[model samples]
Structure formats: C-alpha cells, structure tokens
Target: MSERPGLDIKLPNGRHIQYRGIRYHGSPQHIFWFEFLPTLLDHTIREELKKTAELAKSTSVSVEQSVAEVVALLNNLVQRAYIRAVDVDRSLMGDGFTKGEARDVAHNVEGYNKYIVEQSNVYVLEYSSNEEKVNYAIVQEDVLDIKPNFCGIGININALWRKIKGKFLP
Candidate 1:
C-alpha cells in the first residue's frame, strides 16, 4: 500500500491527532473539519495539497526543498544587484553627452531583471550632464532622485535604499 501524505494518530484516550506529512500535528477535527463541511463552506487545503504533490512528483523535488532552493536563488540575485550596477555604470560612461535633450536619464539597469522575477526591490540610476557624465551608476537599492542641477542625489539614493530594503528584506 502507498503511504498517505498525511496521517491520523489516535491516542489511548480516543482523541485523534492529525499530521500534515511533516512536523505539523493537530486534532483531526481542527485539520479536516473544513474538509467535511459543505462545498460552499469548505476550505481548499486538500485541493491545494493535491496540486502541490503533483508538482513535486513531476519536478522530482519535494515542495519543502523547492521552497529552500527558491529562497537561495532570490538571495543570490539580491547579491548580484551590486555587480549589475557596475555594468550599468560602464555602459553609461561609454556614451557621450548631448545637451538640451532632457539632460538627465535615470534608467533602471539591474532591477529590471528583478522585475521579471517579481522581485524589483532594487534600482540603478545613471546621472549625466551636458559636459560630462558620471561613470559610477547610483544604485538606489530602494529609492531614486533625479534633478536638473540640484544635489542631494546621494541622500535620496540612500533613503530609497533603506525604504526598499525595509519592505523586502525584513
């Protein structure tokens, strides 16, 4: 017989203990009460679990393990944001400047990739002027500031970094 993904363990006192295939243990009524209820009132935990199991079996990776792998991948991308900023800076530095045409362009260089993954918590900006452009891209790990001539760009970048990191990291 195939082992059930979940199980019920009964105690000597006739109380039923339910398990969710892992360390999750609780009363059967608490775990499966929604299952026994009417269709309109029932929750979809069973259906969701079935879908998860199907995905895991097809991928040959357990759901728990997949979650860990995904988290690690996200962390790696977060670290790569730094390298991406350097590349953006180099590209901007290579381009010569022309006056009177917006004069300022703050394009997202690294975090654009993160947006594809639905994790656009970081942004890089390229500050340029009419005469010369800065090679070092302003990495707004949280916020970005664009002004014609006024300064405080660094302060705005740091503030934005703090805000974004606070929202996504913790």
Candidate 2:
C-alpha cells in the first residue's frame, strides 16, 4: 500500500508534529480521530525520550540504567494501547502549556493522576484499572512540558509496567 501524507501541525507545546490519515472532521472531534492517536503519541513520546536521554548526556544528572528499562517498557505501550483523546476547546490549545489544562485533565479524566508540577508543566498520568492484563497512560506533550494541550486515555494490554511505574513517580 502507498504511504499517505500526514497533516503537519504545531502542538500546543511548541513542538511541530505530524499525523497521518488524520481527517479533521468537525474540528477533528470525531470518534475516528482516536484511531490516529497512536501515531501522534508514538512520535511525541519518543521525542520526549530523546529529550530525557539528551538531558542526561548534556547535564550532570545521572539517569540510572533501570530508568532506561522503564522507558523501554512505556514505549512498548505505544503499540498495545487503546487511546481516548480528550476534547478541549480548540482555542485553549496551540503553542504553549497551561497549569489549568493539566489539572482539568487529571480531575476530569478518571483513573489518571493529578499532577501539580511547580518546575514543569509536564507529567505522566498513569491509568489504574482493575484489569489484570493491561496498563495505560494519559500522555500529554509526551512530557515535553507535557501540556494538557493534548491528553488521552491509552490502555495497554499488558500485566507488567505496574511495578516499574513506582520507580519514577515523585
């Protein structure tokens, strides 16, 4: 099959991103939009992993090897996930992060953690479910100021990652 072109758009966090086969039906709020989230989020999250890896490389901070393992595991969730994209006012989104948007996502979305980050706008919202074989995250900016500008309900059909998640949470 021939590859399709993606919609080149700017994320609210000042990052340029692309979405393939993304049809903006009624402002992109259609249920079908959820079908394209893995592509969008997979790119966004890997970019974030690059940033974190770079920070460790450039700065004095040291990232433990176990940390890399956790990242790898989360990356795996990118494929095994089922995402529920949040519906926000289009005007409120675009080119920057806001604390209110972050809070709104945490409070309004079930199971995701509420994060109050003083130094950064980014945080991972891990979803807790009763299912024994799955894990999920509400990824935003994929942690690049991981804005509330875009967040989702991503469910991973895996029994692992539950124990590893505790290693990074503050």
Candidate 3:
C-alpha cells in the first residue's frame, strides 16, 4: 500500500483539499485576522513580546532571537485554532465520511463562501444538504459562527459557550 492516504487538491482560490488526510478548511490568515487577532490583541501575547524585547535589550539575547521566538509562538497558536475550526466543520457535516464525500462538502462550503463574500461583508448561511436543510453553516468574513447544534443549524450565537465549554470547564 502507498503511504499516501488520499488525494490532495489545491483549488484556484488558494483553498486546499485532502480526501482522508489533513486539510486546512478555510484561510488561516482570515482566521488569524478575524478571530485570533482580536483575542490576542491587548493580551498576554503583546505583553510577552514587549517583555522579550526589553529582556533582549538588557541582556545579550539578540532582538532577532526574541522576535523569532514570538513569531513561532504566535504561529503555533494560530495553527491550533485553525485546526480546531476545521474539526468543528467536519463534525457539523456528519461522521465517517469518505475522502470523496469530504471533498464534496468542502467544495460546496467553498462555493457558498465565495458567493456570500461577493455579495456583502456580513455572514453567509448555508444548508448542509439541499433536500432536508437539516445541517447548515453561518460564516462571516471567513470566520465560521460555530455553536451547539441544539441552537438549530446555521443560526448565530453571541457566545459559543457550549461549543467551547469543554476547553475551560473541569
């Protein structure tokens, strides 16, 4: 058997597709700008960078080294958050989907995303299936409005409490 698990596709719009393996769903830069940046802003990330710069100035550590460290940290955080978003997208779609099935879902999601962005700056709502309209998506400026399915598919929530409750609650 080949080491490759499934097919890889790079779309014209810069989105990537991996059938069974890992594929980043949306634009990571968008997630960084729309989701991560706002949370990181005026937070420990800034304070840590300032502290590192000051420490580099007083000590023998070069400014370049400090900058590189900060960059690496931010990159790690961004990647993890992006992956989490992709997982949520997958869960919303359904379970035990093949590579081809995932590709179809991704393609549909991308189409809706492009269509919505072209029309306006607000969020785009999408149904998972054309027939039943059971599952849906709500995306704005590329950031998905993820929440518990109990809220009804495609509906937006002010806070993703249940969606993210596991991360905080013991």
Candidate 4:
C-alpha cells in the first residue's frame, strides 16, 4: 500500500501537526488520525519510568522492578484522559452538482477525522526522592486562545510532556 499524504495543520496550540489521509471526500472517510499515539505513549512511559526509577533509587522504593505496574498506571492515566487529543475537525460538504446553477438545495455532508479532547480535570504526578503524589486542577479554555486544549496538573504530567515533546512516532 502507498503512504497517504497528510494534511499539515496547526493545533490550537502554537505547535503545528499533520493529519494523514485528510482529503476532500465525496462520501466519508474514517481515518484514525491519532494512530501515532502508541509509539508516543511508549516513549513517554519509558521516560516517566526512568524518572520514577531514579526517585525510587534514592528512597529504596524499587520502582525499577515495577515497570509492569508503572506501565499499567500510565495506561490508566491515558484512558482516564490524563493524556488526550484536542478537538478539531475540518469539513467541506455539498451535493455533487446542483441542477440549478444560481439556486439549489445542497446534499447532506458529514464526518471526517474526529478528535476528542478532555478539557476538564488535569492530573499531575510527582515522584521526588522525598515523596510521590498525584494531584489535579481544573481549568477553563480561553475563547480567543488558539493554543491547543492542554492537559493540566489534574492530568498526567507524562502525557502532557508527550505532547510538549511533539514527536509523532509511527
């Protein structure tokens, strides 16, 4: 199969991103734009593990042996919206060709790559040599802000860093 060309677009955040296979569709296209998420999650998880391991090393927590458990925790964080995508969809729809040139009713048009972002609670986790604690905070989006909807302290820090790192690993 040939690789589909992606549409380069900017997120609400200042950072720009690309969505593969976003083309004008006469019908509808179901593209999982976030397919690059797993690899992203992997790198993010490893980094978080290293940090936690270092902290544990200082406190005798032995989190180095808890890779599996930490991984599970990370997965849960993602599922719980610690890490999430920002909402944005672009679409242009109309019936193929209207009978009347000047005035005519258009056909129904819907669907594209849908992105769901959790904009509420942002969770934060800190594992210092002294302590490990998870906390959260709520934030409202600024209407005029083009910056992407981001996860907050209420969200997972690892997840937030993944986005900030901005590498889409395939």
Global lDDT scores for all candidate models: 0.37, 0.38, 0.44, 0.38
Off by over 4 Å in 3: 1-37, 41-44, 92-170
| Candidate 4's TM-score | 0.30
Q: After superposition, how far is residue 41 of candidate 2 from its true place, in Å?
A: 1.0
lDDT of candidate 1?
0.37
Off by over 4 Å in 4: 1-21, 24-35, 64-69, 81-170
Give the range where candidate 3 is weakest over 10 consecutive residues by summed lDDT.
119-128
Off by over 4 Å in 1: 1-60, 94-170
- Enumerate residue pairs that collide in model 1: 142-160, 142-161, 143-160
Candidate 3: residue pairs that collide? none
Lowest summed lDDT window (length 10), candidate 1? 119-128
lDDT of 3 by residue, 90-114 (tens): 5544544632122223443344334
Index of the highest-lDDT prediction: 3
Whole-model alpha-carbon lDDT for candidate 3: 0.44
Cα error of candidate 3 at position 165, Å: 56
**2 versus 3: better TM-score goes to:** 3
Tens digit of lDDT per residue, candidate 2, span 1-170?
98788666665345654557754444454422333443455455555555654465455343333235545555444423422233333322433364112213332222211111210122221111223113222331132222232367444423234445756755
Write the residue-wise lDDT of candidate 1 on 110-153 in tens digits. 34333323321111111122121222223312234533335633
Task: Name the TM-score of candidate 3.
Answer: 0.30
Model 4 has an lDDT value of 0.38
Backbone clashes in model 4: 13
